[model samples]
Target: MPLLCHNGRFADTLDPVLAGDNPSFKWGEGLFETMRMAAGEIPLMHLHWARLQQGLTRLGMNDAALQRSVLENILRELALRNECAAAGRLRLHLYREGAGLGFVAEAAPLAAADHGWNERGWSIEVFADARIAPDAYSSLKRANYLPYLLAARRAADTGVDECFLLNAQGNVCDAARGNVFVVRGGIVQTPPLSEGAIDGVLRRHLMSLLAAAGRPVQELGLTMEDLLEAEELFITNAVKGIRWVARFRQRTYAHAVCKELYGLLGQPFNNALVAP
Candidate 1:
C-alpha cells in the first residue's frame, strides 16, 4: 500500500526546506503539530487544523488551503502505510520559504492506549527557561525550541520523565508537550491562558468537560507550591492524552490527577476529542 501521495511522494523521501544548517532549522523557522492516529484516522482532525491555522496566522503565514492540502496529502499517505494499527505519530512540516513545501512523516511506534483517566501519571520538574515562545513573535510551536528542549533533556537526565516550566513569578506554567493541571480538594485547576503557555485545544476541551460536570475548573495562577500541595497533578496533550505526575523535583504526587483526568477522558474517544 503506497500512501496517498508519498512514493514519488513518500514521507521518508520528503525533504525539509533546509538540508544542512539553514536558518529555519538553525533558528527554528517552522512549526510542527504532534498528532495521534487511531483506527487509521486522526481522532481530532479539524481541531488540530484549527490550531495550526491560528499558529500559521500568528507566525504570519496564513493559508487555509495550504494547511488542508498538506493534511489531506498526509492523511492519504498514512492510510496507505502498513503500520496504522500499531500506534504512530505524524509530523506535518512546512517550509516558510517559497511555496511552503510540505513534509509529512510517519514516526516510529508510540506506546499509547486507553490508560484510563486515573491510572496514567508522569514525574515532572520545573525549569526557569524551558519555554521560549519565539519572542520574535508568539510561540507558535516553531522550530526555536532549544530552551525547552534542553530543559526537558536535563529533566530526563535527572531521572524525571519531563519538565514543567514556571513563569516569571514562579508559578507552574506548562510541560514540554502539554498543559499542566492541579487538583485540590477534588477541584481541577490549570494556569490561565495569559500565563504564556500554548493554548492547547485538548486542554480547552477538558476544561469544558470539568466545568460541565460541575467539577471545579480554575484558570487561575498556579505556583510550584500550589502544585506540590495538589492532591494529584496531570499533564495533557493530544497524543500523551493525560499523564499524572508521580514526582516533581524532590516531591512525589500520588498521581490522583492523572487517574481522574484519564478516567474522565476515556468514557469515549470523542470525549477526549470534543467538548462536552
Candidate 2:
C-alpha cells in the first residue's frame, strides 16, 4: 500500500486521520501544491513553498506550524516510501484542522514522473460555458477546483487533450490544467496574472529562463484569435514543464520553438533523473 504523510507522521491511509468535519473536506477550505521530484530532489521547491505561504496568508489561514524544511523532509521521505525517489510527482495539501484556524499538512505521491516530453503536441480548445473571474483567489491553487474539473470533463467528452478557460472579460486566462503561452513572430507571450491566469511555478521559471537567455516573455492578454494566429502554442505546469499544442480548432502549430524551449529547461536537470 502507498503511504501518505499527515502532520509529520507516515500513515497507510488518511481515512482514520482526517475527520468528515474538517474544513478541507466539508467546504474546500485549503491550499495545495503539486511539485516534481527528480533525482530524489525537488528542484522547484522554493517557488512552490513561496506560493504556498502566499496562499496561506491570502486566505488568512494560520501557518504557525508550516515550516519549509520540515515539509521538504516529509515529502522526500514520502517519495522514498512510495518507491518513486528517483522521479515522481508529489502533492502537498494544507487545510484547516479545526475551529481555531490551525491547519494540517498532508503529503501524497501523485505518480512516477514521465521524463520525456510529448512527441505529439496536445490538442486543446476553449471552454465557453463559463468564464473565470479575475479575482485574488484566481491565482492560487486552492482546494476548490470546480472550474478546471468541469473544463477537463468537457475536454474528455469532446476528445481533446485540454481545454482553455477564459476570464470574465473574454480574454484567454489559462488552460484547464496549465498556463497558456503563445509564440508569434519569434516573440513569446502569456497572459498576465492580472488577466486571471494561475500563477504557475513552471511558468515563472520558464519566464526567468527565457529572460536570462535574452528572450524575455511578454505578459499580456490573449484572445482566441491570438491563439489561432500564433505560430506555436504551448501549456506549462510544474510537472510537465512544457507541452506543445498541435491543434487548436483548425489551426496547427509548429513544435520547433517548443523543442528549443524544452531543451533550455532540461539543461538544469541534465544531471538529475528527470528533465523537462
Candidate 3:
C-alpha cells in the first residue's frame, strides 16, 4: 500500500483524528498540486511550486519554510515509501489545519497521478452537462473538483480517455484533468486563463519552451468548433506530460506537433521504466 504522510511525519493513514468538521472534507477549502516524479526527482518543480505558491498566497497561507521542506524532503520520502521513487506521481494537498467548525488557512499533505500513461494516443469528447466558471479559483488546483470529477466520469462512461470542459460562457476551457491545446494551420492555440483554464505546470513549461524557440503558441479564446476543426489536439498535465488525441467525435487528429513538443520537453515520462 502507498504510505501516508500527514502534516510533516509519516503516518499509517490520513489524520483519522481530523473531525468531520475539517474544512477540506466539509467545504473543500484547500489547494493541491499533482506533481510528476522521475527517478526520485521532480523536473518541473519550479513551475509546480510557483503555481502552488500563488494558490497559497490567495488562501492567505505564508508558511514558506514548511512548504519548501515538504517539497524537498517529504516528497522523496513518500516516493520511497510507496516504492515508486524511480517513476511515480505525487500530489501535495494543502488544507486548513486546526480550525474548528468553519474554514481555516493552513497547508496539508495528500497522496496522489498517472505513471507514463501516454502510449498510442487518446480519444476524447466534450462534456456538456456543466461548465467551469471563470474565476480566480478556476486557475488554481483547489479542492472544489466536482466538475472535473463529473467530466472524468463522462469520459469513462463514453469509453474515452478525456473530456473537454466548457467555460461559463460556452467556450472550450480545459480538459477533465489538464490544459487543452489545438493545432491549426501550424499554429498552436489554447484558451487564456481569462477563459478559465488552469495554470498547469506542463502548460507553462510547454508555452515557455515554444516561446524560447521563437514559434510561440497563442493563448486566446477558443470554442468547440476550434477543437473540431483543428489539425491536431493534445492535453498536458504534470504527471501525463503530453498525450495527443487520436479521435474527438468524428474527427481524427495527427500527433506531429504533439510528438514534437513532447520531445522538446525532454520526454519526461518513460512508462516502460515504471514498476508494475
Strongest candidate by TM-score: 2
On a 0 to 100 scale, what is the lDDT of residue 119 in model 2?
A: 74
Q: Of 1 and 2, which scores higher on TM-score?
A: 2
Give the alpha-carbon lDDT of every model.
0.64, 0.82, 0.77
Residue-level lDDT tens digits of model 2 in 177-217: 89999999989999999999999999999999999989999
lDDT of 3 by residue, 31-141 (tens): 777776677787788887788778877877654535565456777877787776766667777776743112212221222234443657899998989998998678988
Compare candidates 1 and 2 on lDDT and give the better one: 2
Model 1 Cα lDDT, one tens digit per residue, 105-152: 454333434323423356677777545332434435666656667777
Error of 3 at 154 (Å): 1.2
> Which candidate number has the best lDDT?
2
Candidate 1 vs candidate 3: which has greater TM-score?
3
Model 1 residue 16 distance off true place after TM-score fit, in angstroms: 7.2
- Badly placed stretches (over 4 Å) of model 3 are 14-17, 63-65, 98-117, 270-276
True-structure lDDT of candidate 2: 0.82
TM-score of 3: 0.89
Clash count list over all predictions: 14, 0, 1
Roughly what TM-score does model 1 have, to 2 decimal places? Answer: 0.80
